[model samples]
Structures are given as structure tokens and as C-alpha cells.
Target chain A: MIILIIIGMSLVTMIPRVIPAFVIEKMQFRPWVNRWLSAIPYAALGALIFPGILSVNPDKSQIGLLGGIVAVILAYIGLNVVLVVIGAIITVYFLSL
Target chain B: MTDKAEIYSSTAVHMIKRGFITGIPIMLGYLPVAITYGVLAKQAGMTLMELTLMSVMVFAGASQFMGVNMIAVGTGTLEIIIATFVLNFRHFIMSLSFMNQLRELKLKWKIPLSLGLTDESFAVSSINKDEAKMEKGAFFYGTIISIAYLSWIIGSFLGGVLGDVIPDRLSQSMGIALYAMFIGLLIPSIKKEKKIAVIALFAMLIHALCIQLGMSTGWAIVAGTIIGGMSGIYLLKEDVA
Candidate 1:
């Protein structure tokens, strides 16, 4: 049962990731379609961060929020991604303590 | 070998080196999250082999996390698979844009290259200034994805082995790491195009509203992404091509 689940999961996941490469290459999208596709990364980044970030520490959701804020500030100030992540981890650690 | 062929090969070598080096930060970013996934999946009763297989086969952090959580609660396999599909459907868009960006490459590279199109890999490849111009750009992009992919697998394996040794508070704190990385990746883009900030903000609002109405996180993100991208079609005037 577990193995079946894993295989099923892999199929669904890989299909979305792989099919576009084979299909999209042969097709030509209009300007608006390309615009929508181009915007997806930013949209994905936004959706990935919010709501999920707050719930990372469900018991004290503020810890996640504070960490997110620290990350934003550090990233805004042009810190390298590694440092920004480290800074957020430190903030969350201290807050959780 | 002809002089031009030698020059092309050397440039390809250079780009491959650059790709691996550029992947370092993403590797760093993936380690903690991958470890977290390992630990959580283990606690959820997954055997070491199962967790590792999931990491290797699925190769998606967020969906793997959700899959394990569902498994822990004894959710049906179909439900879990459906959720995984919805959560990962965003990759279709990413893959489309990514292939278009590297259209200079042959079709043969796109299949394997698309397999590695995670959020972090896609973002880095898309933002790279020299991506379109490099010789063997597929190999360069593949190297970047390969480094990050190796880190994920290694980190998950280590986490499975070292599960009980890691402190609870520290692992919990690591939960914030992936989100931090996302912000880091997004900020530079937002800085360049202030309109991107609006797109991000709008997506967040839509996601929040979806959650308020009792949508699953997976579906909500899809909703937010589609709606947000549509908003961009109007907000962004520049030609994407």
C-alpha cells in the first residue's frame, strides 16, 4: 500500500513537471499567455511564503511571522540568501526559546 | 578538433563550473528543509528506505512534506496523490517559461532538464543573466539543479540517520528557513520591478482569502498563483519575450 502510494505520488508530480517541456516547446503562446507564464514565479514566491510561513510554528505563529520579517529586511538590505536564511533561523530560535 | 569546436567546449566547461558554484546557496537553503522533511517523515512512521525513495522519486520538498503528513494521519492514497498534483501543478508554468528561456537548446535536453524544475532551481536559472547566451546552457542549468538535488537527497538521508540527535527547538526553527529563502529569491526581483511586488502582494491576499474560506493549502496556492498571474497580464506592460 505504501509503495503504491509513493509510485502514485511520483507519477502525478512528474507528469506536471515533465509534460510541459515536451508539449510547450512545440506550441507558440500569444503575448498575454507568455505574460501570465512569466509572472508565475513571483506569484508562486508570494503564495509559498504567506499563510504557510505563519503556520510553520502553529503554536506560536508569531515566531514564523517574526522570522519572515527578519528575512524580508535582511534580503531587502541585499544580504546573501544564505545569510538571510541564517538570520531568520536565529530570530526564530531566540523567539522559540 | 576545429578551433571553433574547442572554444565552444571550453565555454561550456566554464558555464558548468559557474552553474555548480552558483548552486551553493540553493544547496545551503535546501539542507535544513530537507532535513526537516526527513525527521518529520520518520516520526510519521516512514521507514528510512521509504522516506529516501520519496525524496528521490518525488524530488519536491513541499509536496513530500505534505505527503508524509497525510500518511501519518492514515489518509487515503488517492487523496494524497490528488493533493500532490495540485500543489505541484505550478511547475507546469515554471517549466514552460524555463524551456522558452532556453529555447536555443535542442529538444533532447528539455526532458531531463524539466524533471529538475523545482522552485529554487527555476528561479535561479530564470534570473541568471547569461543563461540564454551560454554554450551548452542545458548542461549549466543541469549542473545547478544537480548540486541542489544532491544536497536534498544527502540532507534527507542524514536527517533520517540523525533524527533523534537533532534538538527539537532547532528543527522547529529550521521551519522558517525555506520561507526565508523564498523571500531572498523574490526580493531582488521585486527591487528591479516594483510591479512584481504588487503581483506578490496580490497573490498573498488571494491565498489568505482562500484559506479563510476553508480551502486546502495546496488548492489555495494554485488559486493564488493563477489569479495573481492573470493580474500581472494587466499590471505588466513589458513584452516578456
Candidate 2:
């Protein structure tokens, strides 16, 4: 059943996550263990974000490609994220038109 | 003991503030996509109740979009589920990393929180070290999930109703919002590293390669994440270790 699969999948997903908490609840790890753990999140974040932007255009054409560049520039400068997304969308729309 | 309790209570407030601040990006990203997913799910022939159930239970943005697309194309239920799993595999890595921070939470809290974790929450929750490590499972999970859950419900409902009228180009363009939010999330952290430059470069390269290989959109994400992560670990392992 779909319900069972959802539960099963959810459990399978949570196991690697929740098991560590139970084991380490009362224990303290070395600072390095802590630091390495901290490093993983940012690293994972970089892995997740970079590809989404750069993967826009394979041929490096003007429309899709330029839109990605403009968005990245705005994003890099700490522009409002929502604005940057809209800017890219608008730019791409106009270009395609 | 009373002093410690007071401190914990104050820290809980701070954690909630931090969690709320982190949800801003999700708000920006979720609005358009969730709306589109709603519209698309409707277009794909899902009934109102079925669409709501998918949003409530799955709660994943991209996978849900892809799942509906698959269903639209007549993909079987089993295949749709498998595709979703593979696409969401990054959450597996995200959850494992958060496990260290979550070391103090009780099982009752952890079970529900972990189920609610998604790409957006994983990104938001993982960035704030203190929030990520909060042993007060109820507060931590409660704050993150509340924002995410509220946004999905509102966005999905709006999209389902209004999606038909929205233009095609606009719907396609909204895909960029989630990615843009991600860049905003990474700015503060990426500024901290020289090696991050290299890892990002490698991620782009791998992504480009994956596209060239004619892989599906979902598979490309998986490949790029694995390569990017390993590049970071290899580059930072010595310093971190």
C-alpha cells in the first residue's frame, strides 16, 4: 500500500539520522569530530546549490546562458534572492521574445 | 539547575529566531514552485483531495513536481516512487550530517522531525549550528516544520486554483527561484573558504558533464552532489580533521 511505503521510506530515511543521536546522547566527542560535522553541512550545501544555477545552458547560448550569469552576479552581490530570481525570469522572457 | 534551565529556555528562543530567519529563503523559493506544483498536479489529473494528500505527506517540492510530471507522462506508481527516492537521496546525506547536531533529542521528537525534513529545511536547518544541534527536539523541529508546512499548504492551494491562468513561460521561469534561494543560503558560508571555490568549480563541471551525457534531470543532481561533496571533503579533510 502507498501508506506503508511512505512509512517504510520515511523510516529508512530517518534511521541513519536518528541512530547517531541515540548513541551520542550522553557522550561528548572531540572538537575535531564536532568541526568535521560542521563542515559537512556547508559542503553539502555547496554541492546542492552550485549545480542548479550553472546547469542552465549546455550550448552556452545567449538567452538561457545570459540569464544564469546575471542571476549569479546579483546573487553574489547579496541582492535580494527573490528579486534575483524574478530578474532572471524576466530577462529570459524578454530575450526569448 | 534552575540557572541552566533558564539558559536553555533563552537559547530555545534564539534557536527559534535563527530558525525563522533561515526560513526566509524557503519562503521566497517555495511560493512560486509550490503554486506551480499545485497547478501542475491539477493539470495532471489529480483530484483536489489527492493533491492535498501528496503535499501533506510527501512535502518535498522538486520530487513532487517531478512525480506529477512522471504521472502525467503515464509512468507507473512504482516508477514514480523510485524516481522520487533517487532524486531525494541528497536528504539522506543531509539527515546524516544533522544527526550530529541532533544528538540530544528524544526519539518521539526525532521521528516526526526527520520525516518533515526536505531540501529546503535541510539547507535552512543545517546552516544554523546552534539550531542544528538543538537537543530540544520539539522546539527545533517545531519551528522548522511549521514554516515549511505553512508555506506548502498556502502555495499549493493558491497554485491549484490559479495555475491554469499563469503563463507557461512564467511557470518555467519560477524554477529559477529555488536555485536563487540556494545561492543566497550559500553566500555567507562560501565566503569562509578558499577550497569552496574549487569544489564549486568541480560541481559545475560535473553538472555540465552530466547534461552532456544525456542523463535525466534527477540523475544529474545526484551525480553533481556526490562529486561536489567528495571534492569538499577531500579539500577540507586535513583542516577539519
In terms of lDDT, which candidate is strongest?
1
| TM-score, predicted candidate 1 vs. hidden true structure | 0.92
Question: What is the per-residue lDDT of model 1 for residues A26-71, given as tens digits with 9 covering 90 to 100?
Answer: 8888788877877877888898889889987998888899999999
Off by over 4 Å in 1: B239-241
- lDDT per residue for candidate 1 within B6-96, as digits (tens), equals 9988888988898887787788778877887888889999899999998889899988999999999999999999989988887877787
What digit string (tens of lDDT, one per residue) describes model 2 on residues B1-241? 9999998898788767766765666776777778888888899887666666677767777777777787678876677667677677666656656655676666666665666777777776766555544455357556876788778978888887766656776756655566665665566556666676666567656766787799765566656656655665457755442
DockQ of all predictions against the true structure, Cα-based: 0.72, 0.33
Q: lDDT (CA) for every model shown?
A: 0.85, 0.65
lDDT of 1 at A24: 72
Model 2 ranges off by over 4 Å:
A1-43, A54-64, A80-97, B1-11, B104-109, B133-142, B165-169, B214-216, B237-241
Evaluate candidate 2 and give its CAPRI docking class based on DockQ. acceptable
